[model samples]
Target: MFSTGQMIFAGLFVIAFATAIFITYQKDKKLHAKNYKGAVWVAVAFFVFIAILFAIKYTLKN
Candidate 1:
């Protein structure tokens, strides 16, 4: 439902936001690596928990 101009503006805003985030992350890459070493494992654990919950729900349904 948005006009063409609004769509273009939204696209530009997303580009700018992504660029800013990239620049910021690049600047702090070393700090993030040092401070967040186990973050990936945490994300995996969270997904596993969600999957287990869904599997239990499906089993109960059947």
Candidate 2:
């Protein structure tokens, strides 16, 4: 187990990292909107394909 110092340092590091990422994403929001417009549909298709595979596997197991 880590001492109090390590834990505190890790917590602070996570907070700072997350904040930086959020700020970067905010700055890139406009560019993302322009370039990655069809991302949602791609994600949906990927999830649907995985679900179908699982359904087939489950059906075969019975």
Query: Which candidate has the highest TM-score of all?
Result: 2
Per-candidate local distance difference test: 1.00, 1.00
Model 2 residue 14 lDDT score: 100
RMSD of each: 1.8, 0.8
| Pairs of residues at least 3 apart in sequence or in different chains that clash in candidate 1 | none
Q: On residues 1-62, what C-alpha lDDT tens digit does candidate 2 reach at each position?
A: 99999999999999999999999999999999999999999999999999999999999999
- The CA-based lDDT of model 1 is what? 1.00
Across residues 1-62, which tens digit of lDDT does each residue of candidate 1 receive? 99999999999999999999999999999999999999999999999999999999999999
Inter-residue clash pairs, candidate 2? none
Alpha carbon deviation, residue 61, candidate 1 (Å): 0.8
TM-score of 1: 0.77
RMSD of 2: 0.8
Alpha-carbon error at 15 in model 1, in Å? 2.4
Candidate 2, residue 59: lDDT: 100
